[model samples]
Target: MKTIYYLFGLVVMAVLTLVSCESKPSLQKYFVEKSQSNEFMAFDLGTDIIKAAGSDNLSADQEKALKAVRKLNILIFKSDSTDTNVVHYKEETTKVKSILKNGDYEELMRVGSGKEGASINMLGENDDIDEFVVFLRKDGVFGLIRVLGDEMTPTDVLTIMQLVEKSGVDMAQLQPALNQINGNKG
Candidate 1:
């Protein structure tokens, strides 16, 4: 009886150890506090999807539209990886746009593709913008973050984009993490 109990304890301890050692992968976090308007979003490169949610003023259709994007992963490719690649991910972002009709606000969305990216094109929208957003990883981890308010300026937006380009989660780090979690070698 004593040996059986010891074996059971060892098994429980092993399981707990595995669980604790599991890495918690998160999306690259990009946050800009005390700047820009009210905006919240997450672009999961792993899943090739972009999600933005904010304000009750949005219409049902807009919410549906946000959910409609089943595939947009092509947006996360490296710019210089292939020169012959016709559909360059970096430049492709300019062609992307979405409209959101929240309860009291109309959101015009524009997300960039490459390392340097931008979302929530609110400068031309309401005179006073208030928003907070994040770029979530495919694993549902939070990555880049953006919080904008009345104090956010156009230059601030540009600066934020630059920062994202310089430091957003790169594929180099992500692929290995995914492989480790899924027990597959890339």
Candidate 2:
């Protein structure tokens, strides 16, 4: 009787293990895991970073947009096109592509070929997008950016990002990572 019970318990454990491992993965989960790896660069920026650009000069609409956004998550796998780097870039970028394509995200734009490309996707229905995702791949670099918010319209995001172009946003937290990725370019 004891042996039979032990065998039954073992079978149950095996099934549970397989089931847990078989669950579908998500882009958010990928970010959480890879952000810790030394091979990748991660930045979790809150609304303050955007406000830093020029909060005092912001229009009413811009302020509303800024408040709607909760945070931005950026993950980058930078490479210089070595054989090992090529392999890592392909693997990580492919995983991200799979997650975005297969998940609930709706593609807003996609440009480029197998070797290089950029894609924009959003989650949520028309005029009420909650998250906007952009992934870009160049010859020696790949990056993912997630703009998470609550009930943000497309226009709102555009308004806030325009502030970044004016060049007042702080890059202190991103300087090191930016240095690593762009250092060899020029």
Please report the candidate that would top TM-score against the real structure.
2
**Cα RMSD for candidates in order:** 19.0, 5.8
Superposition error at 61 for model 2 (Å): 1.3
- Residue pairs in collision within model 2: none
Per-residue CA lDDT of candidate 2, range 20-119, in tens? 8866889889999998997788888887775344458777888888888999999988876689988888888889989998999999999998878999
Give the per-residue Cα lDDT of candidate 2 at 54.
Answer: 41
Worst 10 residues of 2 by lDDT: 49-58
What's model 2's TM-score?
0.79
Instruction: Name the top lDDT candidate.
Output: 2
Question: What lDDT score belongs to each candidate, Candidate 1 first?
Answer: 0.36, 0.85
